[model samples]
Target: MQGHGYAPPPPKRPSTGALVVLRVIFVAVPILSIGFLAWVAPLRAAIVTHRRADWWIFGGSLVVLGISFAYLSTDHTDDFSSPNGNVGMIILLLNAAACVGHYLYADIRHYHRLYPMVYLPPQAPAANYVYPQPPSPYAATHPQTPVTPPAPAPHTPAPHTPVPPPPQRPAPARIDQVRAELDELSDYLRKRDGHYDGGRDGR
Candidate 1:
């Protein structure tokens, strides 16, 4: 049984078809760069990977090769017009062109396959669409169109309500006592002012 702290080791790097293709190209760089990209010419995937400097190197090699082929193809004036030399010269020039053209466009996809960090499938571009911009309050679009006033909501007629008069309070049972207290207050006021007004005056 495995221990509780035991953790499985990380997975090893995966083998890709691109890595296999690169191996084939490297091997054939001597005799003939053949394989899927070579024999299947006209239609080919990137076979060999190249660094930025590799392009210049390939270009220089092509120039040197072209010059060499041209020199060999030239007549020494001894057989300048012979059919045999002419055919060989044509063949050399054609081969040089083909080599240059093939190397010029060799596959650029390599690091992705060789290194684990760089091999991600190409992300498809996000679908593009002009989303309707939210309307801005500062810029009103329909200033000319008059806004019709909303019709006043119909007013419901209030029902006629007869408010009953407040209930009549029962006559006070202490009316007599209240009147006696009032007469006493009136007499005390009259004595203080030295002006007496008999009850008969208001009666």
Candidate 2:
């Protein structure tokens, strides 16, 4: 039965014969090749190694090439001149030396495939891969209104219970009724004092 398994091994790398052929073409093309070598190899090496030395080498080679051309142009004599007149030839030699140095460094790196161009498998996701939750169908149709807390009930000052005016002194006992009650109270007190005095006289 067909079942899933680990991915197959990567394809094998091709031979370098084509690259060799291309290098020959660059060398065969006269003036253009010098310009190409001055820039291409050092730039490629720099890109791979991220080294400042590679770039410095490229700049130095380019300056030397310019000075060489300038000096060569000023010398009108067809015969090879002495030391002073051969400055252009000397500078050209220096430029060639720089190109050879850069080429050797780049060649070593290329042989080891230190910075090869090959397809790499995509990296697996991190361990904390949380699957996104699907959106609810009802959410769009019935949007939930935000539930705001109910405002506190207004405070009413307890209805002023109405103290009932202290029972109104029993309606003042109708004035005459009040006088009759006071007379009865005074007679009882007088009788009580007289009885106490009689008992003392008897003793």
Best by lDDT: 2
Strongest candidate by TM-score: 2
* lDDT of each residue in 77-187, candidate 2, tens digit only: 785384534887777755665665566567556555743677889988788788898989999899999999999999988767666655555566588798998999999
The per-residue C-alpha lDDT of model 2 at residue 136 equals 94
Q: Which stretches of candidate 1 lie over 4 Å from their true place?
A: 1-17, 25-30, 33-50, 75-203
- For model 2, the stretches where C-alpha displacement exceeds 4 angstroms are 1-14, 26-51, 79-84, 111-203
* CA displacement after TM-score superposition, residue 103 of candidate 1 (Å): 9.4
RMSD for all candidates, in order, please: 27.2, 18.1
Worst 10 residues of 2 by lDDT: 27-36
Clashing pairs in 2: none
Residue 129 Cα positional deviation in candidate 2, in Å, after optimal superposition: 46
